[model samples]
Target chain A: MSLFIVNILDGLVTGLLLFMLCSGLTLIFSMMGVLNFAHASFYMLGAYFGYQISTYVGFWPGLILAPIIVGFIGAAVERYGLRRVHKFGHVPELIFTFGLALLIEEVVQYFWGKSQMAFEAPGVLKFAAFSIAGNAFPAYKVFMIFIAMGVFLVLLYILTKTRIGMIIQAALSYPETVQNLGHNVPMIFMGVFGVGTAMAAIAGVIAGPVLGTFPGMAVLLGSIVFVTIVIGGLGSLWGALVASLLIGWLQTFAAAYNLRMADLLVAIGLTEPVDVAQSMLSDLWTLTLPQVGPILPYLLMIIVLVIRPNGLLGKRET
Target chain B: MNRFTKSLLGAAFAGAAMVGSFSIAHAEGTIKIAFIDPLSGPFASTGNQGLSHYKFAAEELVNSKGGVLDGQKFEIVAFDNKISAKESLIQLKVAIDQGIRFIAQGNSSGVANAITDAVKKHNRRNPDQQVIFLNYSAVDPALTNDKCNFWHFRFDANADIKMDALTDVMAANEDIKKVYLIGQDYSFGKAVAAAAVKFLKAKRPDVEIVGNELHPIGKVKDFTPYARKIIASGADAMITGNWGSDMVGLGKAVIEAGFDNPIYTYYAASDGITKTFGEAGEGKLKLVMEGQLNPPVSDRAAAYTAKFEKQYPDYDIGQPRIANVIEMLAKAINKAGTATDMAKVAYALEGMEHDSIWGTKVVMRASDHQAIQDVHILAHTAKDVTFDFDNSGYGLRAESTVKMASADSATTCKMKRP
Candidate 1:
């Protein structure tokens, strides 16, 4: 069905956007063994910065420059701020990131105030890509999918093909050995942290118009980022990709169809068919794919955590 | 020597006595009013706006003009609610512990329900200490319908009232044979959608119900699939109870799909969506608001906005709902002639007939404490800017069309004023 195809595409695009944030979080979690709660806050910063820069110099350049600025800030935080907190143990590192997340939101409010910023789509990407089953898929959505895929590929290439990539992987599994092997391990950690944050920033630039640049975006995206990383496995990039796509597709399909629970119950012989109007749970049980989209990723994460523990494709790190 | 010592002691005692008397004179007793809302978390934007409006009303405006009540100065005591129902229970206790009697604002219905229960329990235990809860927003119809409280006074129309009014507008346009109903999945959204369906079915029996979709709130980052559903449903028009990102994203997705069908939405449209779609949204979307920024605004509304713009250069004064509530509350206090007695204030508010910036007089129904006001319908228009290379500019112009709905017709509360 055309509806089926459209939902798949919608899911793919949504999944890819989730991947952008999850990928960065997974990389940082693998390398540092500390969950950076502020990762989504960095993404929010990207959106606000992109909005400000685009307002002055147009959206395209802001798209490019905002990530770099965010990258430097991430790197600086890892080097000076996070490094000091890291010595206090993993809990303190998490607490620092949490504090950073709260601070970033407050700072954003102080600057932009508590209101939604109207970030419009650029002229070039305004039109629909094409129509399927009487529905037009916008050019911006295609642009977003390509941008996310590009980021994923670039990250994959850097992690696998390059000498620095091998060094980073070695540092992640056996940091003590890697440091003993005479490589600048701390510098590498900081670089990876910066690179991860930059990816989230890139997502923010592209997503700002669609999501609306607001003070609450960071808090909204924060848990989802954690969910994606957890479901994928904290240190596994491939696991994250798999989980993101799965979640995206699952939610899209959920919101697209309207399947009432009463129908299911009657078919399964659990309950007799009665007037749906009489049931208090009828309205609640009318499960549509769209209604379940946002919570699907968390549900998947909890399921994965209970079952696999180490994630679908993740290797257990000491 | 004894006389000199006595005179020095007497001078010190007189100075101390003068300082004590001055402190007592300045105090005059402070009345603490709690401003309860989501001060932190995702809904903080709405919550913060509510807080700001209350502060401006209490401290900068009302209190500055010799306070709301004679012999008592109104003091606003606010706290970060975190926007949770369970958290509101704790916050209510904290507010009570701080000696706050009159609660001014509650943003969400879920949180308000918890606070109301807490207030009721406190009242039952100590019959003399009953707190008055004034709600500004939270448009769940059940608040006035099944869950009407004697202590709670809702200022805004419930979801049912607004939806009924919306249905009335659509009933006149016989050409609109089919409509797609979309709303955020919450109490407010469900109530609005239910009211729309009920009224539309009863009034327009010939009209077909095409698609009614309830999407998850805050989680819908991409609404392309939903737009596809609307298009496929072949609806004549769309009525949405979406606000914030859901509204913005859904509008953009719908616009991009070339879905030229009219969109009739419940929420205000001064931000996000109009800003996102720009000129593309012109003539396509019809947003209903309480007041308009365009000329023909009442002298009071114009002067208030002008003064507000001068005071806060960054803020958009087009959002007059919160400010209007503040003015109405102030007027209620003035009419009652006593700020300390909430029963008197409530009585004044019930029968209160006042003119607002909308250039129309609103009457507060004494039955349910709901305000009957005019809904300003506007169409988005493209601005002709020669400096722009493309059609990148848009402005919300007030359309010539006006539709009026009486406040009494929508309310289900069968209350007789005491």
Candidate 2:
């Protein structure tokens, strides 16, 4: 069915966008054992910056400039804010980031106010790239998919195949040894942190037009990013990729299918209730898959946490 | 759960502090009115705009016209309820504690229901300390029907009334063969959907109901999947009761996905939705509401529009009902001969007839406290519109008007007068 294909495309777009955020978050967690709670806020910053710059400069220039500006902000945050709190252990770092998240939201509201911004994709991407079953899949989404893939490949190369990547990973476990080798570990940590946040901003710049650039944009994607990386295995990049795609397809298929729990219960030998609205189990009887689509990722995270606490591809035993 | 509850409590404290600051510099003898609505969160823009309207109307209409009760200034105070029913009750207690005698809130029907119930009980418990609720935008018919309260006076036409007008216009359009209904999964959303189903069936029996869907309120990040479903459903037109961010998201997504059919909406033309819809849905969006904006109904309407644009350039008078609320409230207060006489003021408001800011007659029906007024169905288009929304060069062009007689719905209200 063309509907089926469209769902796949839709799912892929959602999954890849999630990956864009997840990859940065996983990278930062692996490089420095810090769970950046304010990662999504950087994405929100990216959107606002993009909107502002595009209003003056244009989308093409904003795309390149927004992330760079956000990277500098992220670097400053790591240098001035996170580094001071780093000595107090992980909980304090998390507390700092959490506070930072709230602060970013308030600052954004102060500046842009609490309404959806009119940040649109450029005119070039407005036309349909293709159509399936009378649905014109726009060019912007395809651009998003490719940009996400490019980010994945480039990040993989930088982390695995390059000299800076080698030093960054080496410093994670043996910071003293890496630092003694005439390299600054603190600066490296800040760089990784900046890069991670910059990647999040990149996601923001692209997805802002589609998902809407609003004050609540960061909060909307906050919990879901945690779910994706958790299900993927905390420090595993490939696991994050697999998990993001899985969630994408799972949610897409779940939304597409109008399967009812009552049908499932009946199929499993339970009798259906008459006068369903008045039945004690009316909620269960009428519950549909699509209604619970948003919760599937969290449910999956719980299952993974219970079945394999370390995650699907995580190397650590804990 | 502990963290969640702590954050909620923290927010409540902060809200109380904000309300505390607003209570100072009251100006003695000023008739204080509490505007309890969300000053923050997802629906903040809508609520904030409502607050601005109340403030402006109180100043420009009531207070500036030499004040009510002969030079007793009208003051509007802000209370952040966060759009939660429980929070709204919390704010109501705070408002009542501050000696505020009137409450204006209309953003959420669920919150409105909670406020009405609390006000009813509060009046019964302390009749001497009664506060009249001036409902401006909450339009659930149940508020005026089964849950009707004597202290509550709704200036906006209820949902059923709007649907009566919407379906009346929709039924006349032959191109609409299949209808898809989508709304937020909440009381207001459900009310709009139910009203649409009832009216559509009654008016256009031949129209096939293709899809009736409900998505969670303010939770959906992407509406592309929903748009894909609508595209697959082959619906000729989609009806949504979503407001605020939901309206913006749904409108943008459907247009992006090339679902070029018409979208019939309740609150799609203001509160930043108009500009977004203008960018995406130029000719595809239609809205039904009270008051006129594009072609100002009269000279006074035109002057008020110009003044509003000057006062709050960022805000449009999204709820013309808010102006009606202030206008009628001031009239009732003046007629009652005392601002503190809640009973007399409520009585005066009953069956009151007044012209709205848009130069239309609004009648506050005695039985239900629901305003019966002319409802206009406006198309969000760039054609033949002088006053554009959000300065987007696309504004509402009135397509059809439903008079009060045809738009009126018979209520099941059994008035329990005090």
Candidate 3:
């Protein structure tokens, strides 16, 4: 059915957006040991920056400038702030990033105020790319899908093929060897941190128009980003891609249907409660697939965590 | 008056100001309405917007006109509830502790319900210090129906009341064959959904109810999937009661996904939503509310909006009822002959009719303490519009109006007067 195809396309868009955030996150985790809890905050910064820039020039200038600005801020945070707190161990780094997230959110609210910004996509991408059974699929969503894929390909090429990328990879496992070879590992880490945050910022720029650009935008995607990376495997880029798309589809399919648990109970010969609304098990009986769609990713993450401690493609334990 | 003087004169000025306030209050007295709502967090914009409206109305209408009950100033003291029921109760206690007899809140119905119960209990336990809840925008019908309170008064039309107005507009449109219902998964959303179903069935029984869905509030980022479901359902039209980012997001998703039918909504034209709906909505998006801004129902309404905008450029008069609330509160205080006697003031507010500046007659229904007024189904488009929202060149134009006479329906509120 056209509905199924529409769901697929929608799921792909959602998956790609998730992958955009997850890719940066997993890359940073692989490069630097600290999982930046302020990752989503960086994304929010990107969206606000994009909106500000777009208002001045256009959406194009905003797309290019916002992510780069956010990148510089990220790099500076790694060098000046995160680096200082790194020696205190993972808990402190976690706490530091957590605090940084809260701080960034407040700073954003202070500057932009607590409301949705009118950040829109370019006029060219405003039209529908195609229509499915009377429903028009936005050109911007298709553009987002391509951007994520392009980022993946470019990141894949650089990480495996480039000299700087090779050195960065070398420093990841054997820092002393890489350092003896005249490569600055700490600077590389900072660069990777910056680059990772820039990727998140890029996602923000792209997703801002569609997902909405508000103070709570970061918080909305915050936990879900963690879920994506964790379910994919800690530091596996491919794993993140797989997990992100999987979640995108999971949520999409979940929301697309009206599958209820009560139906299964009825099919199994269980009698329906006379007063379902008044019963103690009302929530259980009335529970629908779409109602719990948002929680699906978390549920999947828990299952993955319990069953496969490493994740789908993770070589090491999470 | 010169800068950088803090030792003697500045201290004396501070002392004088404190004594001045004390003398002012002691002389003519002050009616303090504790504003307990989300003053912080994501949804703080809605609460802050309401607070701004109340303050501006109090200053411009009541205070500027020589105050109420012979120079008794209306002071709005804010207490952040964080939009939580528990926090609202705590804030209610704090407001009550401050000797504030009047409580004004209208953000979340859950919070309103909690405050209503707490105020009811507070009045029962301590009848001498009775508190009156001046609700401005919580639209759950239960607050005026099943859970109707003697101490509480709702200025905004409840969900069922608004639905009554909305269904009137929907029934007139012959093209609307199917309607898809979507809402945020909460008490208010549930109330709107239930009322919409009930009203539509009663008014137009032939209209097929297609997809009815409730997603977790503020959780879903992309409504494309939901949009797809709506489109696939073959629904010609859609109705939703979603607000805030949810309203903007849902509205944008459905509109962008090519659901070209009319999308009826509540609270879709405020807090940057109007700007987002610009160019995209084109004429599809419509909402049911107390007043239409673009057409400027009257010169007074237009002036009030202009002055309010000059004062707070970042905010909008989303809740037009705030004007009615402050003016009526001042009138009730004067009519009751005392600001401290909340019961007497409540009696005054009950059965009171006021010709609003927006060219509508608002009647505070005595049975349920619910304000019945002329409700407008306004379009968020530029057709026959002047005042644009968020300066987006797209504003509300009245599509239809449900007068106060027809807006009033049978109430199930059992009057339990103190």
Ranking by DockQ: 3, 1, 2
Residue-level error in angstroms, candidate 3, position B327: 2.0
Runs of candidate 2 with Cα error greater than 4 angstroms are: B1-25, B69-71, B84-99, B125-129, B405-408
lDDT of 1 by residue, A29-100 (tens): 988888999999999999988988888889999999999999999999999999998888998998999999
Q: All candidates' lDDT scores?
A: 0.74, 0.88, 0.88
Compose the digit string of candidate 3's lDDT tens values, residues B229-294: 888889988999998899888889988899889999988887788887778887799888986676
TM-score of chain B of each: 0.80, 0.91, 0.91
- Displacement of the residue B272 alpha carbon in candidate 1, Å: 5.9
lDDT of 1: 0.74
Docking class of 3: medium
lDDT of 1 at A217: 85
Which residue pairs of candidate 2 clash? Answer: none
Which portions of model 3 show Cα errors greater than 4 Å?
A269-271, A278-280, B1-28, B125-127, B405-408
CAPRI grade of model 2 = acceptable
Q: Write the per-residue lDDT of candidate 3 for residues A167-212, one digit (tens) a residue.
A: 9888878999999988889999999999999999999999999999
lDDT string, candidate 1, B1-418, tens digits: 2222444665678788978866653234766778877876656756765666566556645666776656456666777778887877777778877666677665677877777667656756765556677777766666665666556666665666666666777888878998999888887777767878898998898888898878888777667777878888878899888887777778777777668877887654543445555676777877665556555366655565555545543334334555556667777777889665666777777767777655766667666666667765656666432111111355455554334345556456665333
Which window of 10 residues has the lowest lDDT sum in candidate 1 chain B? B383-392
Evaluated at residue B234, the lDDT of candidate 1 is: 79
RMSD of every candidate to native, in Å, equals 9.5, 4.8, 4.6
